[model samples]
Target: MFFRLNMKLFMFFLAWAFALLASSLASAATVEQIFKVQNRTIKRLCNERVIVTVNGLFPGPTINVHEGDTVIVHVFNEAPYNITIHWHGVFQLFSGWADGPEYVTQCPISSGNNYTYKFKVQNQEGTLWWHAHASVLRATVHGAFIIHPRSGQFPFPKPYKQIPIILGDWYNAGVEDMEKALAAGGRPELSSSFTINGLPGDIFSCSQKGQNSETFKMKVKQGKTYMLRMVNAVLELHLFVTLANHNFTVVAVDATYTDPYVTDVIVIAPGQTLDALFTANQPIGSYYMVASPYKSGGKMFDNITSRGIVVYDHQYAQYSSSHLVMPSLPSLNPMMPFLPPFNDTPTAHKFYSNITSLVGAPHWVPVPLEVDEHMFITVGLNLQRCDPATVTNDTCKGPMNHTLSPSMNNESFVLPKGRGYSMLEAFFENMSGVYTTDFPSKPPVMFDFTNPDIRFDLNLIFAPKSTKVKKLKFNSTVEIVFQNTAFIHTDNHAMHLHGFNFHVLAQGFGNFDPTSDEAKFNLVNPQIRNTIGVPVGGWAVIRFQANNPGVWFVHCHVEHHTHRGFNMAFEVENGPTLSTSLTPPPADLPKC
Candidate 1:
């Protein structure tokens, strides 16, 4: 009977490929929204006080969606303080209790409660954002999520307007008087403008240019093709944009998709996100975009830059209300000028190792041949000795009195608090004294980590806070590297890893040998990023596939090096079924 009809046609095509993967996971679709944070009062560099906003907008709204869809949201806080949003590069696959990260996933919907959040945008698409993960109000919340790709599928081409930008970083001494001037010991000022989507634009004029303007603009259309997304929420600065004569083509980042990369200056850091595309075909009118501020390892910033206009499409030209259109730009170092020069660092390591992934497009992925864990961390800053209940004052003005901790492999993480819950509800109620799964994988003492004479190695510049982490083992893969140190300072950091999105695979500078940097790995088509920038003293690597389970949060998106600790956390462990685990919590999570 012809070998039993080809084994009954291979068991009817393996049950019709699992019934079309359970009918496209039962046609996704969930999308909800609510947010509402509160307290708004716009008035950028000309101050009007009272910040923290969400529905009253201030770079807030925008969730859009498609890629498999299932957003939700809700929020509500009403701002007095305590918050938590973070969807930054969302990979909350099994929805790590909607991965928001206050005390790392849940808790802090306080100051007038309300939570919600939900997840799933499965195979991601383009730009991603959403901020505040608690306190210092992420310098005025954030926004933009935008996925799109399900039935209008696109791996490129198809754009006549999308824009978004976001950027941010303004400190007219707001976030509660810069947290009461860093709790009285001093120093919390700098950044007074570098906005782009919340305007600081008309060159912060109070004169030399009659007030008004609020900037922002955009408008495009001279030959179609537009896109832009961007994001970087600049808190501790790390930008380097430019749109003047335009170029981009990039395609995506942070929200994945790549391999188009046509650059002409873009860099970005602080919790990244890019997109790009361009094509206004120059000549029709208005330009000026800028953004500047690329500091390498710190020494005071806010050397202001942030502009934005773009314009064009007024039907073709001639329209100036008050004379504008100033752009020019183009010197990659033609004797230095047009942007990127706050220690260029090889033009931010040639635009983050020239991106890659986008191979055959459409849900690409591939790059996890095998590797169950291989860390090596390191990162920057160190120096403890200043415990007046830690940095609140009382006889400790820092340096010599020490203070700024920040670490990674040499420890310093700490973020526990009382033990009522959070830390993913103390790993879902199994609560073992709040936290500690070890977290080291390397460096208890390694030296010359890019030693510029290792800041007079006081036995390697101090370290040790606690709440450690790094457990991970559920679908595994990992890899890390990171490195970057200079004994007492060094900079560039950015790191950021939450639910997930890795695979940078290489970034270099000084030490990271692995026997000649493992022949410069790029496991074919690298660059995936969920925030990277680690290269001031240099070293990057990355890799991923832990498969999202829970207790996420990994830090250094800067905000004073994540409040002087750089941070850490991973936990993972689950995936042996119940649909790759991590679900429980969310019966309205928030509770500490």
Candidate 2:
């Protein structure tokens, strides 16, 4: 019956190379591609800045594959800095070597060097992506990874076309400069502009220190449905996206199929993706596709909308108009559609909580009934003492001569310096002293986590920095309650895992109560995702089966937070048999 409903789409795209995805269905394919990491002088927001990019494209080339195919990619680093590419949302079954994070899986592929990553995409089919895993490079070195199901396997409403919209930020300075500024324990510089498909749209002009960007446009025939796969690739900001007066039937998220959710606005955090289908049932003229920052507390910069135009083919116009209709969102910029206020928590919560996995569908994984390991991890910003007498003035930029650091379970994660081996390398070769498997399952102490008026506790303000990981048994069912705290201030945190997608059981504001929150868990059909944006000063719960044996990094997707020690890893022990264990590292793995 599912096949019967989606057969039209299956056959429609069987030969149609839509969205520039040139793939065949004779059999599962072996996709071979090369990514050249280099720097290019690009003019954006009235500045000619040298930005590091993959293949010189702001949003690099798309990697299109099917569900059961193998992917082999060679990344040659020509940029001046070290880099590593992460295949986000890919379940790296028996292929953890290719799960790239700077110090988790492998060291950085140094400049003038290259590394080969080989993996397979199995039992997953939808929108995923790849981006630079080190520092703020992901702002430019990212692209879409669309996985199409085999013929007759697609289960969704038939759409006439598919579109990939990559939402990002624009900065005048180079990414390294921004990293250096943030390393001083201060807030990073503000983004000059928000972008849609690499453009900040025409509303912004270089005369106002903004880029003269081309607005992305989607041309559609009247009455035809189109599927748009949207990715939030911003450095630290969450985005609120809407297509003027159109309604969307959201079908998938983070490569997982979901129950069709109809909504007008899309709230996407960093490192998240959404797929929605909309019909061109409106008038013949063009409409605005607007995106803006959905910031919930924190500093503000260039609070504006990144836009695109939705132009319908007027040849067969049913409701033709002489002039185009514009969206009615409240705008900071004149003649722009921008209604989503910076702190629209209710809308964001609705979009995040209402989504559920399309259970009983093909290739759906059921929620594990038994939990072998349960954890309560606190995610928050802490302060590290920076003395004027001992350290330079540059390092003491945080409040009260303290640098802004972050932590999980009150233990600030300090990744091992590239000292000849990554954590995975040390774990694989029995090299000791690099990392310890002692990450705690809960915070050391309890307090009013989200209270802003209470005097801050000195111990809570500073997490003892260390490199610690939680050890998990192979194939163990694990549950985690991620508590978001307000040490310095409360802000949304986008937590991402490396090798596996977890079931988002529940999310709420303030502290997490075990008894009451456990009752709210959606054990039947929770949304499965690799990344989740825990609410500001709130908490979220997730569960996953530690079936893959590897060293997987779990960190905040807001890259600057990861740099500030908001990260940890899981050392899942080897499975019982050879087939279930992690494969040996490749010969050309990068050496520190």
Candidate 3:
């Protein structure tokens, strides 16, 4: 009896040990995905057009992972052009090689080559996205990257369902051809149509005929809350979104949790994401959700509205029609769900200012108390003299044989060739001629930044091109006043930081007055984000700690502005400890 009892106890202990091992292995498993980029003909808006896509998925594939998971993506670029994928809003802590801005972090994956991006998602949980960082491929090569809370419980109440709504633009002309045309100093042509989940919704004229014509639709049950993760992937437009007869309580932005704020309309600029929760308490009916462009600079844009549908599941049963009757939805004309005016700066300002960080949240970081570095940068559109050899009567659009050239300060950034070395690699190797650390702390010349009549002098509007970066010591606190200049054109610009999310200290229209505006800074519980839109002809103050060591890209998120050279980089020195320093580059980093 004693021997039998001993054996039973030993077996129980062994089973417990095996169970613990299995759980540990499951938690530490790496999430890997293989993406194949190829050119395929896809039918959209009633026309068949060839587009570059990943794994033949129109909007690519949605990558869902929990927080603290290691994501490994092997991208095989079979397309005709080079490509690079940027995980937008991922902190990429100590892993700058995977931060995927061509030439800045790593070289672009060349045509017909493969590169593997491996990075761990640390301390971030919310909605983010990934998109092509090379040329204009992001139009179709984009998808949602949703990070669930690692603790298995969200900060707010769990919702009945979660959905991703990706807003994008469609261009009729070939994207590469468009880039070449702009390079030749021609006027920019706007996108032909806007899309929801790669579908130009039913409201579009071209979407009415094709057998595959589709619109994004969501069915909800009454009295249940749903979380919508909305991403603005449009290249050059700020979008105003509305859901008919419903209001949303915004829970987060750019993957950072925020105190709930309720609003009827949400204004999201390119590269911005919003996570909102709304209870389906309205009357049982179908409603139309709308997305329209909010033109800030009076520039011509695609004036059409993209539509999606939301229906109460029981509404079909209420109709009691054997013919599968469709519930009446609001008319698309005039957009029933009202939006603010196209240039309503006040509305946009209110939405941005009201979002305060949720203190004590899992990822909350307090605003830095003292700043070691302060930068006052001016970003806006400028002009440069067009080369006579490449200029023609049809090509030169700006005044005095010049063309549109956007810049940060007086220097328009030019990407370094680097001989196939990334900026971080070049810095660590002590290589010269890759990039300079003389990026100005303030604008070279300052005038009334909001003056509307400042475009008279062609020389003043011309910005010289260079690749400049700002260097900072490890663990330093940095503050920046991102002042938007109206020299050539006054428009809203969304600025994105690659490696960290900063606190939006304050933002307001007109020039940012140091004396008065200093008092308005929210030192406590300021909203944290990786991207914040500097208001049109206005300014924003942001603060962050340079704890992560590496080369980080700071630039306007608008693809047009970024392509036109409105960008700079930050080089942070390594800390005293190895754990705080940057890890060595992976063996499979892409070559130029």
Compared with the true structure, all predictions reach lDDT values of: 0.78, 0.85, 0.85
The parts of candidate 3 lying over 4 Å away from their true place are 1-27, 209-211, 315-335, 387-390, 393-395
Model 3, C-alpha of 589: deviation from truth (Å): 1.8
Model 3 Cα displacement at 539 (Å)? 0.2
Q: What is the lDDT of candidate 2?
A: 0.85
TM-score of 2: 0.91
TM-score-superior candidate, 1 or 3: 3
lDDT of 1 by residue, 1-592 (tens): 9989998999999988876665465447788999899888777666677788888888888788877878888988887888888888878887887777777777788878898887777777888888887767877788888887765656777887787888887777778777765544324568778888877776666411344667776777567788889898877878888876677888888887888889889888887988888898866667778888888765667788877777666555433697754444322221212677787888888887888888778667878978989989988887776664655454355456666677888788868866777787777676788888888899887777887787647778788789878898888998989988886557778888888888888889888999999788988889787789888888998888888777888899878667766789899888899988877886777788
How far residue 365's Cα lies from its native spot in candidate 1, in Å, is 7.0
Q: What's the lDDT of the predicted structure labeled candidate 1?
A: 0.78
lDDT, candidate 3, 197-249, per-residue tens: 88778877767544666677788886789999999999888898889889999
Error of 1 at 208 (Å): 11
Off by over 4 Å in 1: 1-155, 158-187, 197-199, 202-216, 229-233, 236-250, 254-271, 276-312, 316-365, 372-410, 413-439, 442-501, 504-527, 530-555, 562-592
Window of ten residues with lowest summed lDDT in model 1 = 328-337
